[model samples]
Target chain A: METVMLDTGISERGDMQKSRVKVGIKKLDLFYSDFQALKDVNMDIEEKKVTALIGPSGCGKSTFLRCINRMNDLIPGCKVTGDILIDGTDIYKENIDVAYLRKEVGMVFQKPNPFELSVFDNIAYGPRTHGLRDKKKLEIIVERSLRHAALWDEVKDRLNKTAMGLSGGQQQRLCIARVLAVEPSIVLMDEPTSALDPISTGKIEDLIAALKNDYTIIIVTHNMQQAARVSDYTAFFLLGDMIEMGPTTRVFQLPGDKRTEDYITGRFG
Target chain B: MTANDRWSSKEMILQYRARQKRRQAIAYAFMYLAAAFAVATMLAIIGFIFTKGISEISWEFLTSDVHDAGREGGILPIIINTLYLVGLGLLFAAPLSVLAAIYMTEYSKQGILIKIIRYFTSNLAGIPSIIFGLFGFMFFAKILGWSWSLLSGSATIAIVILPTLIRTSEEAILTVPAGYKEGSLALGATKWQTMVKVVIPTASPGIINGIILGMGRIVGETAALVFTLGSGTDIASSLMSSARSLSLHLFILANEGISTSKAYATATVLIVIVLILNLIAGWFGKRINRYKDAR
Candidate 1:
């Protein structure tokens, strides 16, 4: 069944000849103090597609994900020397507004972290931050984002209840709904399902599959099956280098690099 | 041979277990006795104050103003003056310390400057109240030309409690999970907006706890209020007018030997006020927690 889908994806890539790139990262080198984390990385992420970054622990996949939105600036003694562009605009430019860039590119963390607030407030927080003051407008945005994330029905009646009261899966879905509230063009997930149960993980994977139609998604995952299941394109990382990146079927079934083959074959990590 | 060896080993294990249980029992008894001693000491002090002061706490003694060096009348004016000091001190200290804490935890870089500021805060907490009184008298009453007045006293108390409030609030802000801050920032909220909306709201209960603790210190203060507020035993009509706090009034009465019972009564009132403040603080903390839960 997945092979059939992969054949369709190949024809789809050919049919959609434009293949517009949403994010262009070039010579992206990141250093935490004197220790380099990402070394001369480059990639062109297609618009409205799911790109999975799979690697072992401390392989710098998460670091690369954060660089896309300049979230790395929050860390002390961390520096970046490279160019990252979103839709042909240089994000690392001095004049770029980081807050605005983040609005354009949203992130979901490994742990489900909702503010100590009501579910409604958790969704409305981004819209409210951007100056949506009308109560009716906020309410509409909250409902719309929840519905888009497929969480509206479970929490529709208890919008005013605290978000922390929700189950772990529900909380993670709420976090996704929160990101959707801002209506960003791209979404970043840093192993968002690592902390969830298998059932919850499947739900989020389905949600990611649905989200890729309108939003470009870059996800970091340790689960190889998940990368093969959800992502249209997969990039394998080994010690801060992109070993191989291609269609998910090719990366899993016919890996190009020895390290990628070894890692995928359960030989060694 | 194996069966005989197993029997001897089992017997030794049982003996060891019995000795361990005896030691555990002894430890529990000693811990209970220590706790009892501490609680008993506090109860005894409260008992002594209640016995010595209960007779002097009549309606007349509560309602009327002090007369003849607090020997014949109520300490109403002194009580009112202390309230003014506490109100003003909190008005200044709460905002300043909370903002300072926010800056330290949220905005400031972790470097030598932060280390120095923290060192100074701990040192400030250690300074004796009498030294604070001297500083307030020289700087606020003399140099600033405010004289011995409510303004001077309130300002002194505010500074005296600022370090403690800041330290408590900093810890509170730090306790907020890093994930929440990162989550807010990822939603495109600016640093200030994140602090105000998410960080401050979560830390508020702890911040309020800190403020109330600072209030307790200010209310019980005697030496500082005596030097800066002038022990006037009169209601302060204006910010600059001389006044006396309950603690200072009690101190003056006891020192003069004019009315030891009146002094005890004033002490009792101070204790009651502190007790009420603590109850209110606890209730407020629970309400804040419930509000944060939102369920």
Candidate 2:
């Protein structure tokens, strides 16, 4: 696996282990005005790995994924404290370019929201906004991204057609393709298959597994089976706290925390 | 307490239901009558205009320049002026209202300031077109020294329709799903880029519909244009040239008793133009729906 390092000269820590952390979040706290959403969240997300954040509704699993890309900033009165280091650089730092940060950390929303444009244009929108104007290059990016999302064959003939004509599953895949076109190092899927059918969910799960070889993926899912099947690492969140995080098999089979076990075993969620 | 009372209770329930059904029937009849009344009024006016003016309309009457105080010749110049006024008014108003709507919907937070702006927008809509005419006369014509010209008239109509334009456009922009903006932003697009690339395009159909409505106002406008645009019968040679629209021409001809037939003819042409505008708007709406439904 290629070690995707976002920042250089971070190897000088004398006795520290050389962990290739793609995202290093430490004691992170988020507040919507005064109501705290995340409390003391600390996690080390490895490079080019599939990590799943699983919890019940309002457990802050989705919030944590959004925090990685600083998307919570869009919400009024939402505030974050502590450090979220992507490739060893603090994303909350004053000098951090949010747009650039987002470029590196692309997000796929739960709902499939293809833009009101042609399939080709929808895929090209990010690259075009980022100043990739060459028609030939945009075409190549669109084709490659669609293929990567496993949607090229289904949509190749209708690339020029409006994206709204696609089925729910195809639209979701197209959205994944849109995210891929920007060439991000990290991909955040916020319940990406929550709105999809069972078959579509399986397809997205397969795509996520394939994607982890190149892009670091952080998925938020309510489906325990999906987390177990697709993720290498699974982190169980409960009430804004990360209760347990470990190898997917270990976390599901032998959870360290009582709450994690309860939640995973369908005792309570 | 008695068997007779029990029978009467059942009878009363049936009577009540029958009465309710009768009232509903009456209400439906009343609604239909009201709709029919409105349609009849419109038809009567259209029929009158067609009967009086259809005979007056000829190729020469349409193409040739008007003479003898618009009694003898064509209203070509008047038609041309009306188009210029509507075109210029839309050109200025569409961008302003769209941008204002974008600002309010996308950028402005919900607060007292937004409330005040909204209040003012409603108030602006309520203000009569005549008031807009006076203001335009004072500001654009006299104050700005533009005088009774196409510029002044267009500017006046722009203000007259601006409130409606802004209100409709704001509603349109608000209807665009927040998901689209979030999707764009997630892809590293800036707020402005998201608004332009996703928000605006999605809202454009509504915005265009609003513009069409505003154009309808501009086309039918006579009171506002009367003062801001001096009653010049010739097609505008320049932006500063004074001109009279079809509605204004119709008004003058009818009021002065120049030619009732000519006035009716002018009204007919104005109605046709409005119908054509609506048709064009409908066509554009279909095109917009193609993209909208897919997304």
Candidate 3:
């Protein structure tokens, strides 16, 4: 029973201190012009758990996750139908403020999307936009966010420097802290460590586990081992359909669907 | 392995080698001849202008007023008039062109009409300056009832340079990265805020280059001003009154047959002003290019 809360002693890490809202998609379908990207995806992302969306390339996992935060709205031809609710409130409501919705549902893109700003400015940007204008308050938020992402010790002294001056892994973590500064309930990471070296990738993986305590974490990754290492639950997608969804231990060891089994075993994406 | 195969075909190979050498010599000779002709033509023109013009140029010539009667005569009044036109012309043209360019690059949707309009603006660069002068005379001087005054001439010159300024500024604004705008807007800043804060500042170098180049054309222009600015070298108080520009003075003194010496003096002064304008433009162009290319 202790193993339920501990993934090799990971619960000692305080992985769920604040993130407790119900998160998921219900019968979600998406299309780009005439081409359908996702079809009827119904899954529940457990509160305060790191859920991994695993699939081959073009499997629509990224599309489904983007729909949650409405990042897909930026694309002119993309259309989303069905419900993506955070805390049981349909976010796509007519009067829902897209700007305010973005603040609640923070995102980290595939690439490190740190602005062409200094390291401090990058983290300070989100809080400033939310109207945290006091210089001392901005300083404190930047410190905490960077520390949460485990980057403050190395970057604190040189926070005045450009974000682009950082290494690739560092930049990705900087982006994560940037999103975290606004204090959102849910964090969507789309292949966040896909571009990092092994050591940097390990650091980000640990940070993701550490972050689940304060925020709901949903990561879209192609690495099967990554899905097993960091997540409590895993959803397997193939060619735009949710093939299987279950506890991480159960999904990889005993997949309910043939496609999930094949994907986990590297028989197909 | 055989000697004949090792050595290859001697007669045919020799003939081909000879032909290749002849072709190379012909190409090199043609390139040098063309270069020589270009340098010679340029030097010849400059030499002819300076031979008659430079001797007539003096400080007194630039400081005095024009006279067909018992009055002081100097090229200074005309010199001042030329500078006035270029300054006033650019003041009107630069902002108007920048706004027009921003509309084309930022607001317009790139339909058939937009494409046609872009094409027409570029084609204006190919139009003769004389035609621009005619429009200036007919529109500003005649229709606007301003007479052959500084206002009409300068306004006409401004119209002549508008297309150039717009095209250059359009190119500058269009080259701004989509990432800059997106990054700013995603932070809750409005679209206009992003443009004013990040986009326009970054593209400023290109816009400045356009304005400088457009002003150069205004400084050197003569055909357009002759019909619009009048043939007298008298300084005026207001844009509503007739005044003589340097280009117009040069033409009149050179053609009047009574004072061709003063004409040469005025022509030399005009060239110096043009050179100054061109140098400033070149310097500005270099700075803008550096800003755009910075990492």
Candidate 4:
């Protein structure tokens, strides 16, 4: 049993054994208008590993993910004071270009949210905005993105059709494909499969497993089993506090913190 | 009354049931009568106007802009003036109102200022067209010193419909789903880019419907233009010049009891133009909606 319990959260894949931090947050506090949302929080997301942020409702997993891409700046009166560094660059610096940051940091939301445009165009929007409009070039980029997301075969024949016409699973895959089109370094998913059926959820889980080979993936999921199954590193949050963060297996098997243990054992959220 | 009631009897139940049926039939008849009254009134008016005036619709009358149809003017210049005033008024009102509406719905914060603006806009919609005319005459014609010119008249007329245009355009913008904006912005597109490329296109059907309704209101206007526009049949100078509209022309003819024949003909033309516009709006609105649904 002890031999089976690997300390660094690796059970199947050798990639999760060790890695340096990709994004580090230090003493971060967030406010929406005047209401405090996230308290002082410090954590590190590992490079080239799937990190699952698990918590009860309103525990700020979504907010924490949003901070990576400066998505909070879009909300009025949403203020944050902290240091969030991506690859040693202080993303919070005043001179940081959000546009370029967004290019590097991509996000997939809870809903599929394929654009009203055609499947190809929806995937092409990011590349086009970055000024890659040569027709043949765009086509190649679209194909590469779809292939990376594992959606190319299903949609290759119908790329000109509207993205809205796709099934739920297909649309979610399309959304993931959309993010891939931008060639981001990190992919943030906020309950990407929460709206999906079990089969769709399984497909996304498979996609996530494949995706970590290329991009650092951070997923905020309420499903504990999902976190256990897909994540290499799992951080358990309670009431906006990081209760325990370690190898996913350790956190689930023998949580150090009583609160984390209680939560994992189903005593309380 | 229930059977448990001591006051109920066999004969009384039958009478009551008959009365209830009669009452229901009377209610239904009342609705039918109201509908029929409206139709009958419209038909009567149409019958009277066409019977008395259709025979008098002549090319000479349409080609000429005679101030007194009994004397000399044909409607050519007056009709032209009406067209000029409408085109100019829409040009002035359409862009400003659409922009204002977009700002209110898309960009402006939903705070005190937005609430106040919405309040005034609704109030302005209720204000009588004559008051607008007076305001135009005093401010545009007199203050701006574009006195008795088509430009002042059209400007005033444009002001009159400004509230209507703004309110309708606001409704159009509001009808568009917030999801479209969210989806676009989340894709790293700027707010302005999202608005122009996605939001506006989705709301175009509703916005055009609003514009068409406002245009109809402008064409049928009489009391507003009477004071704002100079009472002349001459061709209007540019947008800045004074002008006469079809409704004003009809009002003058009907009141003065001369060339009453041309009034009905012009009225028919005005009705036809409105119907054509409404048809075109409906067609475009339907086409756009179908395209969106297909997506």
Q: After superposition, how far is residue A147 of candidate 4 from its true place, in Å?
A: 3.0
- TM-scores of the models, in the order given: 0.95, 0.92, 0.75, 0.84
Where in model 3 is the C-alpha error above 4 Å? A1-19, A45-54, A61-71, A107-213, A216-235, A245-254, B1-91, B146-151, B223-295
DockQ, each predicted model: 0.68, 0.66, 0.22, 0.29
- Where does candidate 2 clash, by residue pair? A164-B294, A164-B295, A165-B294
Which tens-of-lDDT digit does each residue in B1-295 have in candidate 2?
A: 8675665577789999999999999999999999999999999988888888888888887888878879889999988888899999999999999999989887999889999999999999998899999999999999999999999999999999999999989998887888899999999899999988889888888889889988889999998998989888787899999899999899899988999989888888888888888887787678666655554
TM-score of chain B of 2: 0.90
- Residue B290 shift from truth in candidate 4, angstroms: 6.7
Off by over 4 Å in 2: A1-19, B1-23, B282-295
User: TM-score of each model's B chain?
Assistant: 0.93, 0.90, 0.85, 0.84
Best by lDDT: 1
Taking the tens digit of each residue's C-alpha lDDT, what string does model 4 give over A1-269? 22124354375446554677899989888999887777888988889889999888888889888888888887889999989999999999999988788878888888777766799988998887776879999999999999988899999999999887889899999988888888888999999999999999999999999999899999999888888889888888776677778779878887788887777667766
Which order, best to worst by DockQ? 1, 2, 4, 3
Q: Which stretches of candidate 4 lie over 4 Å from their true place?
A: A1-18, A261-269, B1-80, B231-237, B240-242, B280-295
- Find the 10 residues in a row with the least total lDDT in model 4 chain B: B64-73
TM-score of 3: 0.75
Candidate 2 lDDT over A89-127, as tens digits, reads: 999999999998899999999999998889999999999
User: Per-residue lDDT for A1-269 in model 3, tens only?
Assistant: 01122253323224445445477578988999999999999987767788999999999999888787777777778988888778888888888887677777778877665665689988887777666889998999999999999999989889998776788889889988988888887888899889889999899999998998878889999888888889887899888899888778777776898778777887765
TM-score computed on alpha carbons, candidate 4: 0.84
- lDDT measured at residue B292 in model 2 versus the true structure, 0 to 100: 51
Tell me the tens digit of each residue's lDDT in model 3 across B1-295.
Answer: 7785776678879999999999999999999999999999978876777788787767776677777721337766676777788788998899898888878877776689889998899998789999998988898889888778889888988989999999988888887776555554545444565566667876887788788777768877888887788755577677876777766766666666657666666666666676776788788778766655432
